[model samples]
Target chain A: MDWRWDFTFDVVLPKMWEAAGVTVWATVASFVLALIGGLILMLLKTHRSPWISRPATEFIEFIRATPLLVQIFFLFFLLPDFGITLPPLTTGILAIGIYNSALCAEVYRAGFQAVPKGQWEACIALNLSTYRTFRDVIIPQSLPPIVPALGNYLVAIFKETPLLSFVAVAEIMQISKLIGAEYYRFTEAVTIAGIFFLVMSLIAAFLIRLVENYVKRSILH
Target chain B: MVPRIAIVIGLAAFLAGLSVATFAELKMFLPAILRGAVVTVQISVLSWLVFMAMSLIAGVARAKASGAVLWLAVGYIEVFRGTSLLVILFWLFFVMPEFGLTMSPVLAGVLGIGLNFGAYGAEIARGAIGAVPRGQTEATIALNISPWNRMTRIILPQAIAIMIPGMVNLTIELIKATALVSAVTLVDITYASVQQNQLHFRTVEIFAITLMLYYCFAQFVRFGGDALEERFSRHLSKRV
Candidate 1:
């Protein structure tokens, strides 16, 4: 195995870091979208009317049941047909956002359900509107607990970024693959990519624990 | 039950309508798609077996072992969990070959996905074991039950009940993982659809069919899981 340290340190590491910027930002953007979309889906799912809740639940299940890669492929392939050719990177962002949004929706559901039944009854007794109930009462209570779960999925979304390489997203995995192809040696670049994921996700997990502590402290205060 | 029945009926109606609309154009592609489906299911099961083995060995070790053995389990669980499946899959495909050990793409995929999801399942396995009531252990001790009998008869039964739901979720994920193998040029359902689309350019129709196929497979796996759970938990409600 021609593991060239000079080439790895000088040539590969810099390019890996450059490509990592794409991976990080895409994860952030997709996660932000997942957060918002999850909230909306959760609200829609728990809506009082069956008409609203039923289809919303099914759609969430469909998204959850299907592979994210297929969804990405579908959107990427279909868009070019309708004469709406976007950048593959943007397509990746949108697709990952949509797929993870469904997962986040389930987390939101679990969080909301964890809120005690009396809270809902209290809102009902006060004759609070649904919007007011969720806003002043439900959201403040529900959002905190789900942060750690959401953060876990955030790490998951980060790991998922490699799949974007399929559509030519120029993320670390794709960049490393290009390097390997060019150099005729895959071990060094690929190993570095794996190490980047392992280290960064460990750091993310650590940061998430810190955030979890912060959120818990704020709630206590 | 009524809503479930209605949903099932509704879905059947919808599929009937959709299939009628696309059947003519889809006829030629059905064989290829089915062949691809066979590959997908094959790899999903293959990887799932790998996942199940790793989950058991590492999970039990993490929960019950000590010293270097526990550290080995910890390393496997954390390393696999921390990294992405695609990276591992590619490493097995691209890097392992450099080590003078080459594997077919399918083997690389099964091992890659199995290793990744196995880490997750191990956590679930550990958690489930931890969830078993402490009193049960005390009772087994007082009754002078052997360790093996205590674990097999009492602890694992309850732990397995807790593990099933998480295991089911992971199994469905395994079905989905099979789709990713297509990225490595394995002609799974996803790759087949991409292949089909190039020929006829019926992008929407072909992918819709593929998605439906995958959804059905995932649902089938979920159903199996539910049945397994039902079997395991049947004794819980019995009155002694």
Candidate 2:
């Protein structure tokens, strides 16, 4: 029941901020993987051929239906059975990437659907190649609408980085727990960690809203 | 028929092979993990109930209110929606204890997930409520139905049907959020897996089993949600 202001000020503040850097890095790396991975999955599922698309749909559904933490645990622990051992950070990043990819795939699909069929026909009428049509016309039109949704998911992933602590990737939560264990002032340690997450998420949300506003204005214009 | 029988026999053989390979390991860990699974289900169900109740309130407030109440509801939705369940879990576990209010780790976890997802559910509920035609409310009033009855019988049931998809997504999210409870030192499936991995150094096997367990649990829930959705839609169509 006793709160320790000094410990919050002296111990947790400094330590958590330092660990926050790792959390941010993990978020960035995982988000990059998620973006690329999601784009690929989205493209695969939406491809012209049923042969390629059907399997991708099923795979995405499987991934979407499962929990990410379980997938992270599986990757961290199970990859070794196939003789693939990764560092904790790598494992954490891969897990976030794969899990977020499934959600992002849906986002991208929705974005793709939002593109009018007329645009595709217009591109084809102009004799643009499929690659050029997708790159120059379809994707540019489709992607902006999806930015806000993608941004929301990115922030969600940033918050989820704490789960990486379970695999011994010493992100913010793990660091806080260590600090708490060392000082026995879990109040200060965990509170500081929570504050760090809250602030980062707020900033992420603000930035995402800004992007959403920008997208809306551009679309309107 | 031969190919069908062959496929069944193949699957049986594969299952037997996996069992032989894993029985010793599973024998050690399955009982512990299954016990943990009970806690997992309890936390999941309790949080789902809490979120649904609180979300309905928040959603209705957002839908009906005009000024500061609306803003407060919006703020609640944004803060909880933006933040991770893990941070909420940590706050409830560590910060709440310092505030002279300590709960069992399980309670803390359930409340955190409930409140967090409740915010999301509120948004879905609000959207579904808004999607209900404005004419429906006018018609209910014209018919002299009590406001409470109008909402309970006419508006809410339809809104729930519409909200099912979003609610299903939130439910899956709640299931995942239960993993964070391990941080509070509760012996969840993840915790048991970690304990076994540490003890036997069979890290991959233990974690793999836990992953499969989660997939199985999640698939079951998703199936149930789908069935509920079908039932609701059928009932709605019959009414129409």
Among all candidates shown, the one with the greatest lDDT: 1
Score chain A of model 2 by TM-score against the reference chain A.
Answer: 0.93
Model 1 clash count equals 0
**lDDT per residue as tens, model 1, B93-189:** 9999888899898899999999999999999999999988899999999999998898888888888988999999999988898888975669999
Candidate 1: tens digits of C-alpha lDDT, residues A178-204: 998898878999999999999999999
Model 2 residue runs over 4 Å out of place are A1-4, A47-51, A80-85, B1-25, B66-72, B203-205, B235-240
Q: Which candidate is the best by TM-score?
A: 1
Whole-model lDDT for model 2 versus the true structure? 0.81
RMSD to the hidden true structure, all candidates? 2.5, 3.9
Identify the runs in model 1 with alpha carbons over 4 angstroms from their true place: A123-137, B1-24, B237-240
Q: What fraction of the true interface contacts does model 1 reproduce? A: 0.83
lDDT, candidate 2, A87-161, per-residue tens: 989998999999899889999999999999999999989999999998888877886878999998888889889
Candidate 1: docking tier? high
Mind giving the per-residue lDDT tens digits that candidate 2 earns over B1-240? 133334345544754586688787667766777787788888888888989987998998888777999998988887787666777787788778678888898788889989998998999999999988888899999999998898889998988998998898788878877877887678777777777776777775566556656665666666778889888877665442
